[model samples]
Target: MPELNRRALLIGGAALPTATSLTPASANAPNNDEAFWREIAAEYDVTREIVQLENGNWGATPRPVQADYFEKLARVNRDTSYYSRRGMGRDLMAVRDRLAEALGVPSDEIAFTRNATEAMKTLIGGYNRLTPGDAVLYADLDYDSMQDCMKRMALRERAEVVRIALPEPATKASLIAAYAEAFARYPRLRLVLLTHVSHRTGLALPVREIAALAREKGIDVIVDAAHSWRQLDFSLPDLDCDFVGLNGHKWLAAPLGVGIVHIRKSALSKIDHDLATAPDGPDQIGERVHTGTLNAAAFLTVPAALAFEARIGLDRKSQRLRALRDRWVVRARSIAGVQVLTPDEPGLYGAITAFRIAGKTSMRDNGAIARQLLERHRIFTVARDGVERGACIRVTPNLFNTMAEMDLLAEALTELGV
Candidate 1:
């Protein structure tokens, strides 16, 4: 196996690592070397019977991380409350420190939650700065639960709910313009929910640009970065948002039930404390979210997950994912009756991409397409709705996946597209 030189990693256009930087050996070595990626694929234990492309729900924990998690689980089972009451707090804090460092934020500004949904709920529900007649905005592509929460928050605060539709076949300029238009149309907008990566269409939004637009209008932005954190090579500072909800299990490949809530230290007071009493007081980020009796093993295994990713390097991981996505999307776009929903523009997409067959906009139609791919082609995918345009089949490939698998998916879609 070829050894990866850490010094060769360099981030380039649209935040993706340059191809030359990804070469493991001499400059002549191909960035997308099949032999090197196959070695990386060996770290995961996936089924051989099927091509698993639907990895967006949650990532499969790497073998090493899984082993660490099992060990922690057994230790917690043996010690029970004796361990929980004594050293668990300290251990958890250390985990938070490591996570905070990875995310480029202070340890005190982040807290753990069961998942991104819980963290987002905390940020959206606990936002207490709204006044009567103020408005909160969300788009069709935002998570359904988060949108519902925004509506409920509006009702509670006597604020208006401004729901908008993102433009289909969107461009970077159009996406930014859409938000700017919304902010202008709703002068009283107090808050907006921004999904850094739309789960429905796999559309990667220009978060920092959109957040900047929201800020000019004095609207607080709560970013749902559930799918973007490790999948994209970016840090918290790059987003420039005050609050964000991140998922560890998704791209980080951590054990299930681990998520992160980030509230910038300067903006901590904007979000009210969790309903549960905070013994640590209002200033502490942990007080902002209270999920009682979390899965200790899952939380304990996060450092191991981070370690595995560090070994591979986020720049390489992200570039490899995009390469896999492009392998299929470029072919799918040329196929008859297929519409690739996510744009190929740099920084506009990542590993996750969605496509729709001609005239198959209904949920049932897309669902059947997903089933067909599974049953006939032995490939796994998911049907997603809630896009303003229509339903689509979402394809997300993990680090374990190979170029051949992507090619197989494209061939399957060609057969089904007709």
Candidate 2:
């Protein structure tokens, strides 16, 4: 239950890097070298028996962050009661402050949650503005749980639920047009759930434009940016929405259970505070969600993780992930039957991409391909459904992954018979 001293943390020799010292020279490297990334990969302790290309699920922390997490976990375990009563709250708020600074928002406007699901459940369900007969909308590409939350919100409000399909071969124009048409069709729509990046196909939607469009129609947009925030080079305000749910574990490389809920101060009035109580201030962002007791150690590890990411630099990280995706996708497209699901546009994707053999759109077929990639080629992947057309095998490469690993996946696709 010790109070965290910022000066001490900064000067805590070998424990946390200083503000100016952590930046790696390679952050500006012009070439992607196996040796260069291997040096970075050394910071991870993952198994090399299989090439892990499924990092979209949860980002693994680097060794430095992991060590710090373990140390803090031990400290919390040694004096649970003392830490919980005296020190935990202060440390938690400090983490929230760091998160706010990193996210370009005020600390009071953000709150920590167990994960994106918990945050979205609180936000989508607690939103108090909807009334009977008003419609809420979501797309096929939105996360399944979030879509479910929107449906439940609709049911609770006696409001109609409107679902739409995004355009195939998605382009900026097509994406905008499809949403515009849906808005015209559902004039009573009150809320919309937009995924910044579709987990199913790794398609990065133009969220800023879509949020603007929704605003024009007098609709509030709740952005599901769990997959896009750290994976892509952008900030919360860049999405131009008042409500957003973000995942720290997925892209920020924080511990497994950290996520964030951001509510613009002006928009705070729309979401009702969860578990009304004196401590749960009606206007406080933290009051919007109730997570009984959380892992203090994991929450404390966020600053370390943020430092690691900043040292590497987001622009460098973003460009590298996209390059890795393009590496395999370009080669896969040359195969006779393979179809890359993500668009080839520069800004349309990040580390994740999904693909299927021509006509192999069923869940079973896509699952088989994912299994084959693991069993036959020793390359890890996942089968994803919920896209408008069908299912596909999703591949995501992390910072530790090399081009050789990506080529192996591309080669495996060419050899796998549909």
Q: Look at candidate 2 and tell me the lDDT of residue 255.
A: 93
Q: Taking the tens digit of each residue's C-alpha lDDT, what string does model 2 give over 218-314?
A: 9999989899989999988788799999999998999999989999999998998887446535568877888878888999999999988876778
Top model number, lDDT: 1
| Model 2, C-alpha of 185: deviation from truth (Å) | 1.6
Q: How well does each candidate superpose onto the true structure, as a TM-score? A: 0.92, 0.92
Give me the runs in candidate 2 sitting further than 4 Å from their true place.
1-28, 276-282
lDDT of 1: 0.88
Per-residue CA lDDT of model 1 for 155-273, tens digit only, reads: 99999999999988989999999999999999999999999999887889999999998888889999999999999999999999999999999999999999999999889989888
Clashing pairs in 1: none
- Note the Cα lDDT for every prediction shown: 0.88, 0.84
Q: Supply every candidate's count of residue pairs whose N, Cα or C atoms clash at under 3 angstroms.
A: 0, 0
